[model samples]
Target chain A: MKTEKGQPILNIRNLNIWYGDKGILSSLSFEVQEKQVTAFIGPANCGKSTLVRCFNRLNDFTPNFKFTGEILFKGSSLYAEQDATTVRKQIGMVFRRPTLFRGSIHENVAYAARISNVSRTSELNAIVEKNLRRTGLWNEVEGILDETPVQLSTGQQQLLCVARALAAEPEVLIFDEPCGELDPIETVKIETLMRELANDCTLIFATNKRRQAARVSDVAGFLYGGELIEFGATEKIFTNPQDSRTEQYVTGRMG
Target chain B: MNSLMSRPNPKQKFALQSIALLTLGVVSLLVWNVLKKTYLSDVQVSSVARVSDPVPNLLGDIYFFLSISFLGVLLGITCAFYLEEWLPETNWVRCLIEGQVSILSGVPSLLYGLLVVTVFLPYSGAFQRTQGFPPAGDLNTASLQVSSFQGDTTLFYIAVLTFVLLVVPRVIKATQEALRSVPIPMRESAYALGANRWQVLTKHVVPLSLPRVIAGACRAMSCALAVSALFIGIYISGYTIQPGRMSGRFALFLGAALVLSIFSSFLSQRYPLASTRHT
Candidate 1:
C-alpha cells in the first residue's frame, strides 16, 4: 500500500481497535506519505484521536485496549512485539491538553532529549534553544527559561509542548487536536507552524475542524463512525469527495 | 432561584454536627480525667524522685519512636513501590499483597501486642535454654522494678516490632495513595517523550509524589508515637503508683506525646498542599 507521492512512511491494513467491548476504529486502512502533513478529519467520537494514538502506541496504557490488524512503519510491522519506547522515540506525539512536567520551562523542552541520553549541559541548552526557536517560543520564553510552565497561558503551554516533542528530532510527529484549546490567533500560529514543519518532519494531524484540515494537510482522511470514508490529496478530498458523507461533512452540512 | 438540589439538608447536617461535637466532648473529658489524675495526686517523696528520673523512660520513648517510624516508612515505601510500579494491575499477587496490608491496618493494636508477647516469650525461653546466650538472670528480670525498658529488653523489642507491624501498613497505604495521585497525564507525557518505565517513575512520578509520601510518613509517625507514648506512660505510671512514686511524671509524658502528635498531624495536613502550590 505505497502512496502515490513516494514510499509510504506508514501503512495501515484493515486495522480494528477496541476498549473492552466497545469498538473505536473498524477496518481502518490508509497510507501515510513521507515528510508530509496527513490530516484525519471527522466529527467528535469518530476515532481520529484513537487512530493517531495507535501510531505511537500511546493507547497501550488504556486498560482493556486491544487492536487487531497491522500497522507498518517504514514497511515493517510496528506491533510485532517492538519496543514501545523505541517506537515512541522515533514517533512523537503532542496531546490535546498541554502536559508539562513540574519543572522550569527549559527542563520541559529539554525532556525528550534528556531521556534520549543527551546529557551534556551545553548540548541540552542548544537543543532547548533550537526547539524553542523552531516552535516560535524562543522569543517569548528565552528570558524566563528558569520559570515554571504554570505561568504560561494554555496556548503558550501547548506551543511549549510542541517544542518539547521537537527536541527529540523524531522522524514523525502526531498532533492529536493540538489547537483544540487555543485561541484563533494561537491556532493560526500552530497551523502555519505545521506547514513549515512538514518540510522536515512527517506529521499526522487529527482534528474535527474541516477547514483547518483542508488549509494545512497535504493528504486528508475523512473518517466517520470508525471508518475512513475518504482519503486522498487535500484538494481533491475537499473539492470532490467520493463519498456522500464526506461531501456532507466537508460542506459543513453534516457530521 | 435556588434549586432543591442546591439546598442544604438541615436534618442530616444537624445530625453530623451533633455527632462531631459529642465525639469532641468525650475526647476532651477523657484528656481532662488523665490530666486531673496526674496533677492532683499526693506529693510523695518518691513522686519527686520519679519526676526527676524520667531520663530512662524518655530515652526508651525516643528509641521506640525513631525505630518504629524509620522501619515503618522504609518498608512501607518499598512495598508500595513494588505494588505500584513493578507489578501489573492485572496481577493477582499484587492484589493479594495489597489486601494483606489493608487487613493488617484494620487489626486492633491490642492483638498485635498479644501476638508479639505470645510468640516472643516462648522463643526467648527456648533460645536461653538451648544456647545459654542470655543468662537466666537476664530472662528472669521481669520484676516491677523500673529499669531502662520497664524491666525487660525482650519485651521492649517485642513492643517495637509489634508497633512497626502496625505502622508499616499505614505507611504503605499512604505511599500508594501518594503514588496514585501523580497525574496520569504527567506520566503519559513522560512516556511519550520516550522515557522507559524506570525513567518515568524516577524523573516524574517519584518527584511529583514525594511531598504526599512525606505526608503519609508523618501520619504513620504520629500514630506510632501516640500509641507508644500512651502505652508506656500508662504502664510506667501504674507501676510507679504501686511503689508510692509521684504521678506528675505522667503529665510530662502526656505533654511530650501531645506535642509530637500535634507536630506530625500539622505536617501531614499542610505539607502536600504547600508543596503542590509551591511547584
Candidate 2:
C-alpha cells in the first residue's frame, strides 16, 4: 500500500459520540490521508457510522445526540467557530440506498451547482455530463437527462447519487456501504467508480463486509465496541491482524 | 382445492346476505341525501339568497392564501433542519427552538388571532405613528371617522400569523423525519469529499428530503385551509350580505379557493410522496 507522507486531510482525536446517553463510540482516533481509500470495517451496532459522521457534523440532527471530540480538516478544528456548510462543500457523501430528488436526472446532478449559485446554463450542462460520465451513469441516463429519477433502476439511482456528489467538486468523498443494496455486478461498477474517484479525492468508506474492505481499501481500520481495534494496510489487517478481535472479525469467526 | 371448499352453511349465507343488504341500504340513503341537497332542494330560496356559493368561494380564497403561506412555513422548517446541523454544540438552542415550535403549534388559530390583535395590531399602529402619522384618530374623538382599514379586520393578518405558527411544527416534524431517513453514509461521503457542512446539506440532504418536506407542506396547507374556512364561516356569518358588494367579494374568495385547490391537487399528483399521487 502506498501511503502519502504529508499533512493528513482529516485528523480525528479522541472522538466520543453518544445517542441519548448510550455511548456509540469512545475515544476513537485516526488520520485519513489525502487521495486514498480508508475503509472502516466493523460489525453491526459498532461506531463506524458515528465516527464518520463526526467529520461532517451530520450526527447533530439526532434529538439526543451528543459527542466529545476534536475533528480537524486540513489542520483547522472542524468544530471550532467553523460552519458545517463550508465543511460539507469540501466533502461529498454517497449512501447505501440512493436518494434521488423528485426531478429530472439532470436536475438531481445539478442540485449542488444550483445551490452554490452556479447558474450558468452551459457550465451546468457540462458539469452534469462530466460527473455523470465519471460515475458511469452518463451512458444510461444521457438519453433521458430530463426524465424523472423515479424512472431509473436502483443501480442507476445510486450512480446518479455519485454524480450528484461529484458535482460539488469536493476534495474528500465518504461512502457508508455504498454497495450494500447493490447486486454483484452493480457493486463491481460502484467499486470501480470509487477507485476512479479516489485518484482525485480522499475516500473514507465504512462497511460491515470484510471482503469489501479488503477489495478496495489501501488503509483499513477495524472498529469494535466503539474502539479502533486495529489499523494498518488492508493486507496486514486482514491477513496478519495484531489484535484478536480484528482477527475474529476478518476471519468470519466473530463480528 | 376442491376438498378444501366446504359447502356454505344456510345460516351463514343468510347472515351474509342480510349484512350486504344493510350496507347497500345505508350507502344508498347517504347518496340520496347528497343528491337531494345538491340538486333536488328548493331552488327559489337558494337563488334568492345565493348564500352558499359566495360564502364557500370567499372562504376558499382565504383557504388558498393560508395554504400557500403554510407552504412557505414548511419550507422554512426544512431550512431549519440544515441550520440545526451548524449548532451541534448548543443543545439549549435546539431545545428552545423545538419548544417554541411546539408551543406555537399547540395554540389554537382563534387564540392566535386574539394574540395578534393584541400584539401586532398595536405594534403596526405604533409603527404608523412613528412614521409621522397622527396617532390613529381616536374612535371616541368626534373629529375623526374610523374607516374599515382601522377597524378589527386585523383579524385576517392575525389568522394568517396564527395559522403559520400552528402549521410549522407539523412541517418540521415531517421534514426532520425525511432528513433522518437519509442514511448517515450519504452525509459522511459528502464530508469525506471535503465538502463543507452547508454544501452537504444543501446539495445532498435537502434535495433528498425535499419530496417529504413538500408532502408535509401539503398537509400543513390543508389543515390551515380548513381552519381558515371555519374562521371565515364563523366571522362572516352575521355580515349583512349586500347583493352587489358581497357578490364581488364572494366571487373573488371562491376564485382564490378554486385556484388553490387546483394547485394543491396538481402538486399532490405531480409529487405523490410530497403531494398526492394520481393513480
Candidate 3:
C-alpha cells in the first residue's frame, strides 16, 4: 500500500466533547497523517460522527454542544479565534445519506466553488467537470447536467455529493459513514473512489464496518464507547492489536 | 365487538356524523351568504361621489391590500430569517420573539385598529407639529377626516401600519413554518461545502422555501384584503364607502377574496415541491 509520509495534518490532544452533558468523545489523542486515509472504526453512537464533525466545526450548530480540546490543523489550533467558516472551507465533509441542494446537477456540483466567489460560467463549468470526472461521474451525468438530481439513483446521488465536496478543493475531506446507505456495488465504487481520493487529500473515514476500515485505511483508530481503544497502522491494528478490546472488535467477537 | 370489521358504537358514530354534517352545513351557509352579497346585491351609486365607479374603487382597494401585504411579507421574511437562521433555536430571545408573534397572531384586528387610533394617530400629531401644521384639531375627528391630503397620507400610513401588524404575525408564522420545512441535513450539506450562513440561505433554504412562502403570502393577502374592508366598514365608513353602500363594499371585499383564493390555489398547485425534489 502506498503511504504519504510527512508531518501530521491534524493533532488532537486530550479532547473531550459533550452535547448537553451527554459525553460524546472522551480524551481523544491522535494524529492524522497528511495525505493518507485515516479510518476511525467504531459502532453506532461511538462519537465517530461527532469527532469528524469537529474537524469542520459542524458541531457548533448543536445546541449546548461544547468541547474542551486542542485540535491542531497543520500546527494551528482549530478552536482558536478564527472563523468557523474558514475552517470548514479547508475541511470538507460527506454525510452518510446523500444530500443535494435544490438545483440542477450542474448547479449542485458548482455550489461550493460558487460560494467561494467563483462566478464566471466557464470557470464553474470547468470546476464541475473536473470534479465530476475525478469522481468518475462525468460520463453518466454529462448529457443531463441541467436536469434535477431527484431522478438520480441513490448511488448516483452519493457520487454527486462526493463530486460536490471535491469542487471546493478542500485539503482534508471527512467521510462520516458515507456508505451506510449504499448497496454492495455502490459500496465498492465508493471504496475505490476513497482510495483514489487518498492520493491527494487527507481523508478521515468513520465507519462501523471494521472490514471496510481495514480495506481503505493506512492508519486505523478503533473507537469503542466514546474512547480510542487502539490506534496504529491498519495492518498491525488488524493482525496484532495491542488492546484486547481492539482484538475482539476486529475479529467480530465484539462491537 | 370481537370482529375486526365490526362497526363502531352506533350512538357515538351517529353523534360524530351529525356534528360533521352540522359543521359542513354551517360552513356552506356562510359561504353562500357571502357569495350572495358579493354578486346579487345592487351596487348603490352615491350622489356626492369621490369615485363613482366601484371598479376603480375596487382596484384601489386591491392596490392598498397588495402594498400592505407585500410590506408585511417582506418584514416577516426578514424576521423569520433572523429567528430560524441567525439565532439559535434554543436562545431565550428567539423564544420570547416567537411567543410574542403567537400572541400577536391571536389578537383581533379591531385591537390593531384601536392601537392605530390611540397610539399611532397621536404620534402622527408629533410629525404634524414638526411640519409646522397646526396640531391635529381633534384627535378623533381628524382621524375620521381621511379626505384631506395631510390626513389622508397619515391615515394611509396608519392603515398600512395596522394591517402590517395584523398580517406580519401570520406571515412570520407561515415563513417560519416554511423555513422549518427545509431539512436540517440540506443546510448542513451547504455548510459542509464551506458556504456561510448568507450563502446557505440564499442558495438553498430560500429557494426551497420560496414556493411555500409565496403560497402563504397569497393566503395572507386575501385575508388582509377581506378583513381590511370589514375594518374600514366599522371604523372609517366615510373614507371609501358611504353609510348606505355596505353591500357594494362587501362585493369588493368578496371579489378580492375570490380572485386571490384562485391565485393562491394556482400557486400551490403549480410549484408545490417542484424545486425541492430529494432523491
Candidate 4:
C-alpha cells in the first residue's frame, strides 16, 4: 500500500474472508490515508468489491460470510469495539447501480441525517442542499427534490447516491464500482465528484477499469485473485510497473 | 398483455384457460354458499324467547360481545407488535411462534369455546365460590349465581379471552407477513444509517408496512367477532337462546363484514397500489 501521506484513517490488517466453504480474500492488508482518494482496480472476481465491503462492515451482511481480521478505524478495532451500525455512521457506501429509497429525492438524501438525529427542519434542509451541491446535483435538481430518484437520469441517480452518503457526514466514503454500469459521461462525472470529495473525507473506491483508477485516485492498489499484488502512487505504478502482472494488466494483455 | 397472450401454438394454454373458466361458476357458487342466508330467519331463532325494545338490542347483540371483542382485538394487536419488536432473531423462536400460529389457525372455534368452558370458566371470578364445573343440580345455580353475582362481567371477560386466542394467531401471521414484505435492502439501508435492529424494525420497517398490518388485523377482527359471538351464545348463554339475542348475533356478523369492507377502502385510500418497482 502507498503511504506518501501521514495519518492513516483506516487500517485493514491481515484480513481473511470466507463465504461458507469458499475463501474470497486472504491475509489482505491495506491503509487508506485520511482525506485522499485510494482506488483498487482489478478484473471481475478479483475481490475488489469484497475488499471495499470490508471497510464499512458491509461484508457482514452477506449470508455465510465469515471473516477473521481487525479493521482499525482511528486506531481502534472497528468490529471489536464499535458495532457495525456505529462504524457505518462514519463510513458510508454508494453502490454501482444507484439504490434509492422509494420517496422524494429530498427524503432519500436526508435519510442518514434524520436517522442520526440531526434535528431541526432547517438544519436537515441545509444538509440536503449542501451535500447535493457538493456532489454537483443541487443545480440540476433544484426545486425538484420532491421528485422520486427514479425520475433522475442514470448519471443523476448515481450522484444522488453520493449526496445521500455525504448527508451522513461520514469520515470515510466508499464507492463500490460507482461507475461500473454508467456511461462514459456519467463515469467521468462520478470520478470528478470523487476527486472533489477527497478534500472533505477519506475516499476508497473499487473499479474494474484501469483508466478510471488512473484518473481518480492518487494512490492505487492492484488486486488480483483476492490479493493485493502491487500498490504505489498512481503515476509511478502506471508509468513504471513493479510487477509483471501489473504490466500485463495495464497493457491490456491479460487480466 | 396481448389478448391473453396469443401464440402460434396455443392449444395447451387454451385448454388450461377453458378449464379455469369452467371452474369459475363453481367457485362463485361456493363463495355464495359461505355468504348466503347470513341473516337470521324466524325458524333459525324459533327457540329464542321473543323480546322487543330491550335496550335497542344494540343491533341484535344481547351480550357485550362487541365491546369484549374490541378489547380482545386491542390485546391481540398489542401482543403481535410486541412479539415482532421484542423477539430475538434466533431460528427456533421464529419457528416456534410461526408454527404455533399455523396450528392455532387450523383450530376450530368450538375447540377454543370448549377451552373457555372447561378450562377458563372454572377459574373465572364468576365461579370463585364453587369452583370446577358445579354439580348437575348446581348448573342453574352456577349461571344465575355467577352472572347475578358479578353483573355478567366475569362471563363477558372470559369469553373475550377465548376471542383473543382465536385472533392472536391470525393477526400475528398477517402482521409478520406484512413486516416481511418490506425489502431486505430497506432494513440494510437503515442499518447503514446507524439504526439498531429494534429501531430499524419499529421506525422504518413498521411504518412502511402499517397499512398491511392494519389490513391483516382487520381480517382478524372480523373473524374474531363472528366466531366469538357464536361461541359465547352456545357455551356461556345457557340453553335459553333469546330470539333478540340470536338476531343480534347475525347483525354483529354483518357489522364485522361491513367493517372489513370499510377497512379495505381505507387501505386503498391511505396507500397507493403497491408496485415492486418501489422495492
DockQ leader: 3
Over A106-170, each residue of candidate 4 has an lDDT whose tens digit, in order, gives 98889888777777989989999999999999998988988888988999998998898888888
Residue pairs in clash, model 4: B60-B248, B61-B248
TM-score of predicted chain B versus true chain B for each candidate? 0.57, 0.48, 0.55, 0.53
Which ten residues in a row are the worst by lDDT in model 4 chain A?
Answer: A1-10
Residue-by-residue lDDT tens digits, candidate 3, B1-279:
012234447774675466446545544553565435432464332233222345544554665677786799899888988887788744666656665676567666655654443346545643443332223344333443332323345556667777888888888888888988999899999999999988888888889999988888777777677677545533342222222223454455445544443443333233232322121
lDDT of 1 by residue, B164-270 (tens): 78889999989988988898878888888899999998998899999999999999888776666445533333223212222465345445544443443332222
Cα lDDT of model 4 by residue, B75-181, tens digit: 65666666655554333454355445655776678557544543465445444444433445555544543343333456646655677778878877787777767
Taking the tens digit of each residue's C-alpha lDDT, what string does model 1 give over A15-127? 99997788998998889989899999999999998899999998888767899999999878888957899999989999999998978999999898888788999999999
Instruction: Please give the TM-score that candidate 2 achieves against the real structure.
Output: 0.59
Q: Which candidate wins on TM-score?
A: 1
Over A9-97, each residue of candidate 3 has an lDDT whose tens digit, in order, gives 89999999987778988999999998889999988888999899999999888877899989998889998955899888889999999
Error of 4 at A195 (Å): 2.0
Please provide, for model 2 over A1-255, each residue's C-alpha lDDT reduced to its tens digit, 9 standing for 90 to 100.
134643489988898887776888888888888888999999988887777766666665554678787888888898896787777767677877887665689988887787778899999999999999899888888789998989887888888888998898878877888888989998888888888888888989999988989999999999998889998789999999999989988999996
Model 3, stretches more than 4 Å misplaced? A1-6, B1-56, B113-155, B233-279
Total backbone clashes of candidate 3, pairs 3 or more residues apart or in separate chains? 0
Tell me the tens digit of each residue's lDDT in model 2 across B193-259. Answer: 4455677777778788788877877787777766765454222321211111223433444455344
Model 3 has a DockQ score of 0.43
**Whole-structure CA lDDT of model 4:** 0.70
What is the CAPRI rating of model 1's predicted complex? acceptable
Give me candidate 3's TM-score against the actual structure: 0.75
Which rank order by DockQ, best down to worst? 3, 1, 4, 2
Residue A167 alpha-carbon offset, candidate 1, angstroms: 0.7
Q: Tell me the number of clashing residue pairs for each predicted model.
A: 1, 37, 0, 2
Give me the candidate number with maximum lDDT: 3
For candidate 4, the per-residue lDDT at B215 reads: 91
